[model samples]
Target chain A: MTAQIIPSRTAAEAALAEIFASAKAGLPGSGAVEKLREESFAAFARGGLPHRRIESWHYTDLRALMREALPIAPAPTRERRAALRKAAAALPANSLVLVDGVFAAELSGKLPEGVKVTSLSAALAEDRPGILESLAAAWAEADDAIVSLNAALMRDGVVIDVAPGASLAAPLHIVYASVAEKPAARFSRSLVKVGAGACLRLNEMSLGAGGRAGQTNNALIVDVGEGAEVGHTLSLTDTRPGSLRLETFLVRVAARAKFDSFALVTGGGLMRRQIFKLFAGPDAKGTLRGVSLLRGREHADTTLFVRHAATGCEGRQAFRYILDEESTGVFQGKVVVEPGAQKTDGKMLAKAIMLSDAATMNSRPELEIFADDVICGHGATCGGLNADQLFYLETRGLPPPEAEALLLEAFANELIDDIGHADLVAAYRAEVAAWLAARARSETRSVA
Target chain B: MLEIKNLNVAIGGRRILNDLDLKVAAGEVAAIMGPNGSGKSTLAYVIAGKEDYEVLSGEVLLDGENVLELSPDERAAKGLFLAFQYPVEIPGVATMTFLKAALNAQRKQRGEEELSIPEFMKRVKKAGDMLDIKPEMLRRALNVGFSGGEKKRMDIMQMALLEPRFAILDETDSGLDIDAVRIVADGVNALRSRQRGFLVITHYPRLLEHIVPDTVHVMAGGRIVRSGGKELASELERTGYREYAEEAA
Candidate 1:
């Protein structure tokens, strides 16, 4: 028999292994949760970092891009905490703040009636009902190594609960902030549970302190109860170079429930946002929209998977990307209609605009319909801005730059309007405007 | 106000305008009547500084400045306008937004302050009313889902708002009903002034009946083959362009 051979581990894998070994005891969990973490870590170890060989990760080679995993970030200093608190105070009422993946109770604001918020660590220690099961549910999928890793290294986050029949007056804001002065990493997980007949609006915003090139892996789980209406928005803006982030959203829509999620990503070294949604009960409706604006050498990937396990469900996914300079964008969406899920209507579309020759966009939309009476379709289109549209605007006295900006803004803002919250829509538009403004400045400087 | 001297333009090495020379002086409304493939639209586009065609050798002067070197927007600021035969449908951009942007951009390029909301609204309301445009239509995306008549009326409204020193209406009457043609013509007549010149490019003499031209030119194979008084338009409508097409060949 020949001698056994073992390939050497990648730098990131080795660093992750070391970090897990040293920090295992300090991780927030009890016996059952600890076992679940061990099992997840074991699964991750068996698979290693996702690579092009993995069908879902065809466009992103995380093992190669994540060269070395940085150490975990430490607790914030008093000054930094105070600064973050002041910043959080200025956000909308009923806000929750997290610093370096850990919940900052002092930074958060008061919650409204019929709503409760608790730190994920406390929930895990107290063995909250269904919390452990929720964390492990996603592991059943074969290509969930990233989610498994997040589970193993998860530190702290928040668990929000909305009471039954309660209608929230204001949206709940969750701000994920990183104030690390040096390269580090953070793993956080949050859950939102909307009870039956309740209505809730949630906003997730991630802010990275300037000059900090850190890595973040956060998971958000949303469970929409029967007849619940939930609107969720995630806006991620981090311009720091060398920063890498991976955010996973797991959403479940129950009977007659309506779930809408919008994600906006701009500026960051390397980013991957993957959403997994399931129609768990009949007559549930789900809508997912994502917009990514990338420039410079930034790279952003948005992947979506929707599983229709219940009959008479409707699902729609629309994504848009605007790439400039040498930036790259990728969109991968897959919709699966289970064998018994008849009368299911699902559609997925991804459209991208490449501004420069050096820029690149990859889109893949797939539909797997096992039911005979279901209507399911997928489409993807990638191209540069329309020449005729640009010329039309220019002929109306708008310069080339101004014309381009207007078209680009319109392209991105069209989806922002679908968020349904007037204030949030305005905020998202301002963010898009700011990104365009920055791009204009860079273009002018290059021309000069 | 606008002069084209020996303007030879080609697209992809195929000549569209062959040594074409035409001039429109201030206070003059010149009409160009031609058959299909006569390059009437090409002449209008070239004057508007569209980049699709290659100018082999020519000079397009607006107010004594060679507009060939200026961009399309710059040409617009220099008081040049072209109402396209087919107005582009731009989704996601409201008609009012496009109008406001165009008006402010032109003003800024001319080093003039932008109009306030009330003033801008007043101008839009006045021009839109003349074209029979509904306020709801202005709230929709520019030219998107608009009928042919509505599109033509929108272009005429834009012309009224811009008040260009010289305007070229390229086949503006095509695809329009008789009622639309009359409405569009009336809108153009309201903008007519001694200081502003107009070039009405069309095949039929129906539009000229409303906005009578001072000079009428017949074009064939890119160049103007005949020029005469307003009666020239009526003559072409009766005699047809078969002779001019053969003459150019």
Candidate 2:
């Protein structure tokens, strides 16, 4: 299969091959990583593309979308630049911007003390300890054409790790910004490690004012350590129709460690966010929550897989989506309790509120348990506002339109309040209200 | 100031209120005493212009304006308020915010300017104090995690804030203790005036004790079967709705 592929004449793929040659020059990582890359490239050559039949990529069929290879476009010139910097202003970091899978060092900011913000190429060139092998082995799937393309073509993706027990106040931010020109595909990854009792706040802003057709972005990793606390917040809003496919990998919560992630998807052409959090240590816990607001033909998919490998671990996942117009929403969540994971408690709630007949929501919640002593539950609700509830509000003198707003606000408000950050909650409420207003206005216009 | 002529209402094709007739003039506090399933709530809701009641036939005239054609918000603009028996809570929306929105909505409909934030706050603060409601409760989400008594208090507070020309109290005393009932009663009484009318719906006469009414109507079989003065409520309290239920059957 490997020999059957790898020889294709396309402008982008040929350029990717050249970039691969440059990335291989003076690579710093050991022969172990070189062999992994060789195997991954070979697998990618053979597999060619992943189809919808692939169970893991059922919701996101990357094979059909990647029919033509889209290589990393070069960085912006001084006079003509995209809004990458403006979109990433919220994340405080030794910030790095990857445009079309290639890094722009000039666009990145300075790193803080004891923090090294450099490209994967630089890390490999320097043979950085604990940087290359773990992620390459764990996250790099040889068959994923996109991840493989990222590995084969990505010149710079920020890699930061905290030495054992070393704490830093500022986080290392990885910003993914897109601009509309041809088919844009970018593969990016971030490997973060925290020390015992250390804390970090990673903020990712997936933003763009507008884009043309054929736009794709894929991101793969983030880690929180034992006794460490990490808070991750992402606000993703795209202009026009584009696709955002991201896989978040989380491991390492020693006893008493904590991880909290709050993801907000304002609107995208199509967004599928997968978060796989593995709680392997006793009392190692985490909370994951997301809100995806969609309108137009935009679609948002949030898939979560949380595994409780140790006893006395607590995990929670709650996500709310408001789909209007002809938009589609999908949520698939699973909480698995392995054997001997006694006292493992988990809860997940996925809710989708549709405002129009064309709006559709698909939700599935699964639980697998081997432990006799555990409490795990998952529930999903898909519907319009309640008739009794709407009548109740209308009876209070709210118009039918305002009544819908009140109900949706009431629904999303449930999760918004649980967001620990007050400022973030306030901002998110405004986002929800704005989306509702826009949806209401557009819907009214169409009705009229 | 309010009149319902030949009112008929149905829920999912089942008639709940059939050809109901009632009237409430200015300065009237009319008590509607009814047994279970007597469509007391249906009457309150239909008159308040709630959706799904399916008013099959009727003319609801509020101060000579045909209200059956108007939205509930429009009725509210015309000075009609329905104190929900079980008020629907709206989380993330503060009580003060709702009050402000409602107040401004009514004012705008009346061609009046919106109250400044400070002015609105002062007005709410007055009602909060008059109703003995904690100021903190106003800051919280509307009735979220509120006690039964507090929810009713919130309803009264909103009623006081809107200051409608007519109001419907739908079993507002169902879940209140004596003290909370007194507070709600006092709040309702404070809004009472010679030009404002109120229709108080209750199954228990306990509420009438706190807020005395001018007249009491016994609703049986979805219609008002008997009419009398305040003494009628006391009579029903002495004798349960069994007599009305027997007659209804």
Which numbered prediction scores highest in TM-score against the true structure? Answer: 1
Give the DockQ of candidate 1. Answer: 0.74
- Complex DockQ per candidate: 0.74, 0.56
Q: What's the distance in Å from true for residue A182, model 2?
A: 3.9
- Tens-digit lDDT string for candidate 2 (B80-110): 8888888877776777766776788778778
lDDT of candidate 2 over A204-289, digit per residue (tens):
65445343444454554666667888777776654355554444444456677888887777665666676777786898878998
Give the per-residue lDDT of model 1 (tens digit) for B64-143.
89999999999888888889899988887889989999999999999999999999999999999999999999999899
Predicted model with the maximum lDDT:
1
State how far residue A14 of model 2 sits from its true place (Å).
Answer: 12
- Residue A287 of candidate 2: its Cα lDDT? 91
lDDT against the true structure, per candidate, is: 0.90, 0.74
lDDT of 2: 0.74
